[model samples]
Target: MIVKFFKNSGGGSANATMNYLLGKENDREGARLLSGDPELTKRLSDSLNFQNRYTVGVLSFEEVNLPDDDKRAIMESFESSLLAGLDKDQYNMTWIEHTDKERLELNFVIANVELTTGKRLQPYFDRVDRPLVENWKQVTNHEYGLTDPHDPDKAQAVKTLNRQNLPKEVQQLKAQI
Candidate 1:
């Protein structure tokens, strides 16, 4: 499974910056962290600042039997990876577990990002429900804001016809007119 989390940039240029950070070039190190590979995490974090306000986790996971020791090892590895990935800033990690008669699930709140103005931002991570290639279709078709381009209320009729679509005499008359 692959999960992505994003924080909303208020709008305009802030949104562009967020988009760039999520791109391949700026997020190469962050992508390494998501791979659950310790060596890559170490190498990538050495050269990049993962603690930036726009930092997002792009996590990938495989299913395994639930074992305490194995879980501990994975968690510890992620903690070390995150620490090395981030810059020198205070951080908080929260873990949430929910159990019902049918199922039990665990969620890790790795970190909460804070803006320069001292406001804590909400994390907006999305779980990719499909394969990466199919997921591209979802992203490509997604509409981010409230506006709709094809809304009837906002549409206007074109006043002029194409010259090729017009009668030949109409074209000559339009030239004279």
Candidate 2:
């Protein structure tokens, strides 16, 4: 499981983000809203009058394909852990599930305005929040037995043929060739 944050557009609007998440801008096959109300989220952002109206990101699950129930549980866990400090009612989040790739992906758009105070809320700050997010990814991966992005062995290393180190079958086949 990997938590990847998208670079927030300076002038990003909630409606635009919602449209992208909803696959209006591009053809996203097998994409569906997992949670939250798009219209209400947009309305909340629109009411705020902030330039950067939302934070957009995706939680990518590599190699492990999960059922819808498990996916929802994972999503809830990730969201709750990632936004632990924020009260439930103070923020709004919209989750979209995408399974077009080999792994499952949950794309999210978080409205930046605090519902209670109408104040700008940046969900993630690089210097402060990155470690927390990274820790969450590591812990969640271990707990769910998902792929660990931090594992060096999990990375695809470039291969070069070592003639002497070839397997017996490969060496025999090569000799015949």
lDDT top scorer:
2
For model 2, the stretches where C-alpha displacement exceeds 4 angstroms are 25-27, 156-177
Name the lDDT value of residue 135 in candidate 2. 85
Candidate 1 C-alpha lDDT tens digits along 29-132: 23112123233222332333334333334332333223555434544544444444443244443332223212322334333343233444333333432354
Question: Root-mean-square deviation of each candidate, in angstroms?
Answer: 17.7, 8.4
C-alpha TM-scores of all predictions: 0.28, 0.79
Residue by residue across 82-156, what tens digits does model 2's lDDT show? 677777788898888887777788988788877888889888887898988888888878877888887999676
Cα displacement (angstroms), candidate 2, residue 6, comes to 0.8
True-vs-predicted CA distance for residue 37, candidate 2, Å = 0.7
What C-alpha lDDT do the candidate models reach, one value each?
A: 0.36, 0.78
Query: What TM-score does candidate 1 reach?
Result: 0.28
Worst 10 residues of 1 by lDDT: 28-37
Candidate 2, overall lDDT? 0.78
Best by TM-score: 2
